[model samples]
Target: MNAIVTMDALTVDTGVRDLRAADHLLHTLAAELALPEDAFGCTHLVRGDRPRVALSLAFPSEPLLRTAQERLTARGYEVTPGVPDPMGRAVLYPGVSSLTGTLTIAELLSRSAIARVTVLGSPGQPAPDTELVTRDHVRPHWHDGELVLTAMPAVGGTLVPFEVPDPTPCCADH
Candidate 1:
């Protein structure tokens, strides 16, 4: 993954096959950096090798941007300082706790911009009729045999992987 930090935002471009992992990383970073929920945004990019995804967070100040850069860099990420687009979309973080419970689709959407939700083994599948979700550190897990809501991390939230124990391996070849 490639990360760019500016005075206004932190953007991450990931090439991992699993979108869940990418979203987790983005959200985790935001929480670690103490960014606000409204600062997060996510989008899928078209790529040939694997599933490419881009996640970003708008920093409220230059100090926050520098702090986030330093933190990510210390964690081995090559954070580059750049100029972010003024009109880029802002993604809001969902304030879901890391507890087990049920949430409706509307409630989830009101808190996050989760691009998609699917079953554990089924990728690209739409959410079920009930649209109920279970939260585990903002990483939506399957609730009562239903679908899992995949969302990018917002401020005050962290990412928890559902399947992959570690997602760094997928980026090694890059």
Candidate 2:
């Protein structure tokens, strides 16, 4: 993904896949830049060999944006300057820690806008249960099948940022 940092926002031109796969990276970057949890959002861009997703995140100031660009560029990401949309959805940063003990599917829904949960492997496979424990980081993984959500520890409970899988094709969009 190529990142574009400007005075007011951070834009990422993600190749092939949408911003869903890069949620963790975005969250990490936001944390590193000290950006507020609600300062980020994404929009779909039609380009390249696949979907060119643009993730635009707001920074507190121009200096912070420049700092983030420099830091991300130093970390090997392609950084540049570009305009970002101001109408993106607010990104929720579920920290790398749990907020409570065990939780049910109902509880998870109450916490975020997660519509469904399943395991990895096939596209439509279900996890067979709605019970989950917490751990360090809770992130989603995309597979050929359904998107699987997993975390560390596999018990207790953590605050997982709820995200929906992008239905766009990975590459060579058919």
Candidate 3:
């Protein structure tokens, strides 16, 4: 799906070289900055010879953005004024805690900033009562200024997010 972004963003590059570290830093920064309720924190994979995970954040207000930039900069991070890409998997967002464990489609929407939930190749949305086993990792993307999650059907007629917490490489043991 195409992304339609009309939001202000900031990026941080502290040479974070892995997803785990990036996730930890994102949480630390969010707490240290006391980010406002509407903030979104995401990790973008920068793959190449020198692979790394880059952090991006979208703030609802200018003052909040500036404060984040200032505080992050003070901590020796390379804080820039824009994001690497529009589609970032959210790590910190409203009601993120409620997304853990099993939840109904209706419960997910009611508890979080997510505006829509879609299932892959289903031809239609899932029933509200359909359960989503979050796997303790629910990464929703920003679409048209609204948060959207895409899940896939799993065993037992339940669902799981498309992006998992731990992913295997194509030829890991080759």
Candidate 4:
């Protein structure tokens, strides 16, 4: 089961400048869901006639996804039909409500300050919690007004990790 959610007609200030605030809101949503911080991918900019922020969030289980959807809808944002990604894996679109803090993935990871490492994958199977131990190597950079996280490849496969941004800048433009 995959889900895709999109919130349209959200008006921001003229000089809001970037989607960093939006990304931070997504991060907060993930935390609210109790999902691991690394499960979300970096937010990217969708350039075209009208630009928008494109972000990818992952959940290790199904129940978590449902809860997130329900929470998002309750907040009065329009959610798109949930769908799957290119990997046939479920995908859910989280509406940007408001950001409570302003911190980057790097800062969040630092807060976690991983003390160990673990790998949960075998050949032909995607590794689970692959970056738990070496999460410090991951770096987040802002690209096109979105946060881009680059993770270190472990065993030649990519693993999604989570982080908690510190001193998260609040979305005051609301």
Per lDDT, the best of the predicted structures is 3
Local accuracy of candidate 3 as per-residue lDDT tens digits, 1-174:
322234567899889987778888988988888887678888888888878889998887778888888888998988888788777778898889778899999999999988888999887889999999999888888776678899999999999999888888669989
lDDT of 2: 0.47
How well does candidate 4 score on lDDT at residue 111?
52
Model 1 Cα shift for residue 75 (angstroms): 1.3
User: Total clashing residue pairs per candidate?
Assistant: 3, 8, 0, 21
Worst 10 residues of 1 by lDDT: 83-92
RMSD of each: 10.8, 10.3, 2.8, 12.4
Error of 3 at 37 (Å): 2.6
lDDT of 2 by residue, 133-170 (tens): 53323444322222235332233332233442344455
Tell me the TM-score of model 4.
0.38
Q: Could you estimate the TM-score for every candidate?
A: 0.42, 0.43, 0.84, 0.38
Quality of model 3 by C-alpha lDDT: 0.84
The digit string of per-residue lDDT tens for model 1 on 1-174 reads 112222366655544445666666765776687776445444334356654555555565778777877777787764545423333322233354323354544555555545345544444543333344344434433233222454432233332224332347656988
Q: Global lDDT for candidate 4?
A: 0.37
How accurate locally, in lDDT, is each candidate?
0.47, 0.47, 0.84, 0.37
Q: Show the lowest summed lDDT stretch of 10 residues, model 2.
A: 139-148
The per-residue C-alpha lDDT of model 3 at residue 53 equals 88
